[model samples]
Structures are given as C-alpha cells and as structure tokens.
Target: MSQRQVVQVFEQYQKSRTQFVQTVAELATRPMNIEILQNAGVMSLLRPLLLDIVPTIQQTAALALGRLANYNDDLAEAVVKGDILPQLVYSLAEQNRFYKKAAAFVLRAVAKHSPELAQSVVDCGALDALVICLEEFDPGVKEAAAWALGYIARHNAELAQAVVDAGAVPLLVLCIQEPELSLKRIAASALSDICKHSPELAQTVVDAGAIAHLAQMILNPDAKLKRQVFSALSQIAKHSVDLAEMVVEAEIFPAVLTCLKDTDEYVQKNVATLIREIAKHTPELSQLIVNAGGVAAVVDYIGNTKGNVRLPGIMMLGYVAAHSENLAMAVVISKGVVQLAITLSEEPEDHIQAAAAWALGQIGRHTPEHAKAVAVANVLPRLLEAYLRAGATEDLQTKSKKALKNILQKCVHLPALEPLLHDAPPNILKHVVGQFSKVLPHDSKARKLFVTSGGLKKIQEIKAEPGSALIEYINTINNCYPEEIVRYYSPGYSDSLLDRVEQYIPA
Candidate 1:
C-alpha cells in the first residue's frame, strides 16, 4: 500500500473511534507497530479526535502513548504537547465523579513511562491537584492520585521532596491508615519511596501512628495486604535501628514468623528478609528473633522452600547462625532440627543443601560438642550420598563440594569415626579414597581429611583395593589435595609418608 493509502485507511479507521480504541488496545504490546502507527502521523490527527471523544477515548489514547513511549519518541512528545494532559487534569475536575478517577488513572498510565511528562505535570501544579484529588470520597480517585504521586515522586526526588514538604507525608500516611487494603498498599509503596530518600520520613509515618496500623496490617486477612505491609515494614526496617526494635518490641515476631509459612513465597521471602535485616544489625532484636522461635522456623522452611525463597532463606539462616553461637546452638537444639537439616542435604536444590551444610558446619565450628553429635546424626554419609546423586552436574557439584569441604574442615575432629582408624564405614573409606585421588591442594590445616579417626588408614586400604573406585577416587584427591599431604601422609605403604610422619610426630 502507498503511504497515502496507509494514511487514508488509518484515518477511516479513526473515524470509528470504538474500532480505533480496540486497534490501540491491539497495538499496546507491539511497541514497534505502535511507533509505526504513531510516526505514520495517524496519532497526531487522532489526538484531536480522542480529545473530542474526551473521557471515552482518554484510556485508549493514554495506552497508545504508553506503547509509543517505547519507540515513537515523536508520538510521546506530541501527547505531552497536545490536549491530553489538560483533558486528563480537567477530567479529574469534571462534575462526573466517575470520570474524575478514570482521567487520573489514564494520567497515571501516561506518566509511568514518561517521567519527564510526569514531572512536567507536577511542575504545572499537578501535584497540588492530585493532592486535592486525594480528598475526594471516591476510593478510585484517591487510589489513582496516590499512584500518580508515587510515580512522580520516584522520578523526581526534588518533586518528591517538594510533595513531602507540601505536607504529602501525613496525607500518604493516612492513606496507609485507610481501611481499604488496596489504598493502603499503594500508599505504603509511595511512602517507601519517600522513606528511601529520607529515612527520617519514617518518623513522619510513625508520628502519624502508622506503626501500630502497619503492625496490625501484617495480620490482615488478605495475603496481598499482609505482603504490602510487610514490604513497608522492610522499607522502614532499612531505617533507624529503632524502628526494627519497635517492631520486634511489639511482639510482632510471632506474626512475622507466621509469614514464614505463608503459601505465598513472595510474602515468605519479604518476611524472611526483614527478619534477617533486623537480626543482622541489632543484637537485641536478633536475640528476640531467636527467642521467638525464628531459628527453628527458618530451618523448617528451608527444607520445603523453592526458587528464590530458598537462597534468601539460606542466607538469612546462615547469617543468623554465623552471627551468634547462641543462635546457632539454639537451632541445633530445636527438636528434630538436626534431622531436618540433614534431610535438607538430600534435596535437589544445591544451594539449599549447601546452606544447610554450611549452617551445620558453623554450628560445629562454634561449639565442638556438635562434632560427635553431628557424626552420630549420620548427616555426613547422607551428604556424601547426595553428592553422588546430584554432584555430577557442575552447579550441583560446586555446591556439594563446597558444602563437603566446609563440613570436613569445620568438624576438626570426627570422634564417632575415630574407631574408623581401625574399622571404617565402606562409604567413608570410599570418600577418603576420593579425596586422596583428586589431590586438590589443601592450604589450610583444616582441609585435611586424615583428622577423622581412621580416615588416613582408610585411604591406604582403598589404595590397596586392586580394582576399585577407591583407586580412582584417591587419584582424583591427589590431583586436588596438597602434595605434601599426599606424598608424606599416603605412606603407610609409602616410604616418604612414614619418614615425614616420624619427623612431624612429637615425642
């Protein structure tokens, strides 16, 4: 088709505005086509038609601009320069209350992707107008204004600061205080942005008495609202250590702990993350989390969590475990937690199992009492079995190796297996062979596998196995372990190891 034919067809289509609206909807996801349509000059002519259609056509025009925002810079420029903003602003002021919200909503969509335009709207006293819209009895208009203010505040810190300076904080805080969960969510999110730039603004929220409201929102029947409140809690948690203290002091840990088990992984994650953040910087709060059954909760959840939740869960648990020996010991003492942790070592998720292993290792390192406890727990063999099951894949193997290495290095002395120096478990003997065969260099005294009761002797017997995986396993260990350990320690049958052992052996 010729350019004029394309233009004429488009014009004919625009004349039937319902079809035009549907056409724009169809093109909403096709940015390039939206650009082609917009740059084709059809949108410029359609703009006047859209304004004439006014409230009825505003959504379609705004949506088209949003799509055009992606590639048709000229169209974005035109929508900004044309009658759309004035019409949107006027629509908010129109006597028809329903259209007031509809117009503000369209403006929100337009401003979301076009920050310069949003800021320009703000500059033209749109901020004040939106603040006024917030006073309307209609929840929809109030919601839209909250969103628009947030988008504007996010894009223009200066504008955001100005809004706060103009007393938007108290209004937004009250939005969170509103009985409606949807409005509360939007209000909290907008407030989060405001808090990010000025953590001090949290006091403004608190002074508005949002803390108790937020704490109660955590118990909201709607899971989505609970999540929003939790997110707001986290954002505030990022501020004054005092805020986290207040949250914890409110006996809110149990509620936050309940969120750990929420079927919604996003809620679980945000709650887990907030717990971690609070526990990290505040020892008093960390102790409270510990006392409130936080450690046991995390250990239980790590066993069942998937995807993103697993990693963050592991990280938080690890941080807590590493942060305090008492916390680590608390987890270790929780009923069946060792068994739970051991079971985690068998999961398909390498990071999850690795984290479990790391936490166990840290516990073992922090308190030597766990060495025998862990050995009798039979977690080591389970980990080895998991390693063989999933360790063939590169990612899984890295996780497995790191976890195994940590457990070995941290165990320091595996007393339950000390008798193994005389009678080794077949698989433990095989593991010894594997470590020796790899010969991976070991820099630290802790990397030595020989410290386990019969671990060194077990390697010798494996080397003697005429046709065993033991031989290959030893070879692999040799390739990876420190040469001195292999050369000097492998000598039950090696002249060099005997001499070196004698020299190092104290009288």
Candidate 2:
C-alpha cells in the first residue's frame, strides 16, 4: 500500500464504531496508534471522530499514549499539541465517573509531556474539577485524579507551587488521611511534590500534624501502603532534613529497621533505600541504624546474596558510610566485607559492580587504613578490570578512579606496593604516582627517602642505602647534596645511618 493510502486507511479505521473496539484492543496490546493519531493530516481526520464521541476515543488515546509516552516523547507531545486536552477536561465534569477517571489519566499523560500543557488543562477548570472529584466522585476518578495531580505537581514544580498557593494542601492533606491505600498513596505522593518545591507547604502539613499518621504508614499492616508511605517519606526527607530527623527521633527507626527484614525483596530494597537517604544529612542516625543491627543485615546480604538485594546493600553501605565515619569503619570490620566488595566488581552484573565500586570509594574517603586493606586485597585491580568490562559511563569511571586513587595514596609503601609499581599495568603505575603525589608531598618519610636515594634513581632502588664509604664519597662528590642527607649521614652518625638503613630493607 502507498504511504499516503496507508495513512488514509488508518484514518478511516479510526472513524468507525467497530474501530473503537479495535482501538481499545490495540491500546491494550500496542500503544503506537496514539502517535498515528497525531501525524500530519491524521489529527484532522481523527478529531472529527472524537469531537462528539463519548470520550471513549479520548480514553483510548490517553491509554495508548501513556503507555508509549515514556519511550516516545514526540508522540506524547503530539497528543498535547492536539485538542484532546479540552475534551479530557470537559469529561472530568461528566456525571459518568468512568469518563472523569479516563480524563484524569489523559490529563496525567499531558502533564508528563509538558507542564505548560497542564496549565491549559488546569485553565479548562480541571483543577477545580479534580478537587470536586477528590470530594464528590467515584473512587476510580478520585484515585485517577489524585495520581494525575501527583504527577503534575511532582514533575512541574511551578504547578505544584501554584496548587499549594491555591490552597490545595488542605484537600491533599485530607486525602492522605484516607483509609483507602490507593487514595492515600496518590495523596501522599501529591503532597510530597507540593512540599518538594514549597517547604512552607511541608510545614503546613507538619503543623497540621500529619507526621504521626504518615509515620504509621511506614509500619502499616498493608505492605503496599507501607511502600507508598516509605516512598513519600523518602521524598519528604529529601526536602526537610529536620523532618527526617524528627521522624528518626520519634522512633521511626525501629519500624524502618523492621522493614529491612521483610520477606519480599522489593520491600526490603525500598526500606533500605529510604533509610540510606535519610541518613545522608543526619549522621547521628547511622548510630540508630547500627544499634538496630542494620550492619549485620546489610553485610550478610552483600556477602552471601546476589541480584538486586546485593546491589542495594552496596548503595546502602555507601549512604551509611557517607554520614558516619564510625559506620564506614564498621563496614570494613564486618566479616567478608572487603572480599565481597572486591567480588562485586567481578560479578556478572555491571550495576552490582558499579554499586560495589561506589561503596568502596565511600569507604576510602572515611578511613584510609581500611581503604588500604581494600586496595591491597587486590580490589583496586578488580575494579579497574570491571571498569574495562563496563562500557563508558562518565560517572562510573570518575567514581572508580577516585576509589583507586585513595587505595594508592594509602598503601604506597605496603607489601603490595611493589607489584602495583612494577608488575601492574603502566597506566596503573602512572595513576598510582599521580595519587601518590597528592599525599606524598606532606609525608616526611617520602621526602626523606626521595632526597636520600638521589631522587633520580629507579624506584626499584628507592629503599637501598649505600655503605658509609659510598655515602661519604657521594656527599663529598656532589656539590648539591640535600642538607638532611649531609647532616644525618656524616661520620659518627654511621651507626644512626645503619639503624635508619635497616628500617627500609626489602626483606
């Protein structure tokens, strides 16, 4: 079929009543039709079919595009650029709750594509329509509108700020108090978005005494609500460190820690993630986690487990270490942590290795001695090998490089040092020297050794000390011998020299 003819056929197909059934099926099985709906000359053809139709077309359009929206921005923009928005808004006021719910979904898809388009959706009186839906409408519409507003408010900060400015917080706060999990999830997510850009709005929620109720959801009997609440809390903690501190102070740690033991891996992962984020600005909270025995759980997961669980445990360690030096050190002391951290870089999964590499970096930043153990354990070479296996990602390479530098800086004179210096890759030696310079300038031992060894000899001879006659001849022969070398190695100082000389022998 000709391309234009094919377009006409699809256009004609969209116009028939039988096509509506087929469209729903197509939307369920495939979402590409929404893009076809927006092609040049296609919207003009489809608009006539949808102009007076009972929003079934619009519902199908929303479903089609929402599924496809994440993968294809062009198709999403085309829907917003078309006139389906007003129809969706009009449907929000319909007596039939199904239409209103469908409209909410479409509005959500529009908001996802462009916040600017949401203004038109709101300008079409969708906000008020949505508010009424929250209060007066079907459960489905209420949930859909709540989810839509959450997306808009979160993705479009200005719209969220406006929504809060318009006194939407009170209604949203009420929705958070709902007994229904679905409504509460949507409400909490929406409120989080509003508070994200408006701390004052968050204060409004807090001052209105929402924390206790929200905290209860973290320990809620419903696992789904618990996840939603935890997700909301994670976002809130991002905005208000004080509130996060307050949550921890109010004994939320015990409940959050309990989630660390959930049978469901997803619940366990999210709980660990939330705890990690909250610990970022509150280092003291790390003690709470440690006291609650989170270290054992995280270490055991990393050492013995695999897959998603192991990966999150690495990220959690990084987060925990970031906030507390004690916790970072504690991770190093944990059984098999060093070995497992090295193993992570060799795991078949690249993401797991990346997380491990990141955690190792965090450990190095907090404790150089522990960082040395990790490096000398051959973790540095393992990480470099993983970096090669993993394709180019600027962040991964940057983080991996920082971790490697820390390892080198701490262990330059270690037993593993010579191998890294001689047998290791040439680039590895260059990196080691680069990192060594960063710390070596401040090291008296390094400075003394550099001057005593003539500074120009191969690093292989760096620890070798000449006999007294040789030293005297060198001091007498070289006009510019370093002052410390002359002062320490002259005449009667021979015994002191012999004492100093024995300290650096390779054996």
Top candidate by TM-score = 2
Off by over 4 Å in 2: 1-29, 32-84, 192-210, 221-223, 261-265, 303-312, 323-325, 339-343, 348-354, 365-369, 372-376, 384-392, 424-458, 461-507
lDDT of 1 at 362: 52
As a whole number from 0 to 100, the lDDT of residue 420 in candidate 2 is 49
lDDT of 2 by residue, 7-71 (tens): 98977865774465446436544555544444434444444443445456655544544454433
Provide the TM-score for each candidate, comma-separated.
Answer: 0.66, 0.69
lDDT scores in order: 0.63, 0.62
* lDDT per residue (tens digit) for residues 1-507 in model 1: 899999999777656775676587577667557656765675565556445544556555555554554344455466677656675675566535555655565566556665576676665556667787788887777887888787767765566676676567778877887787789888877776665554666666666666676787776667777777777677667676887776666567777888888888878887887787677665566678788888778767777666567665666665666666676666567633364455465566655666656655555545445543455676666556555673345554455445444454445343433333343345455543443333324433433544343454445444346567766665654555556655545545477556778889576
Among all windows of 10 consecutive residues in model 1, the one with the lowest summed lDDT is 435-444
The 10 consecutive residues of candidate 2 with the worst lDDT sum are 455-464
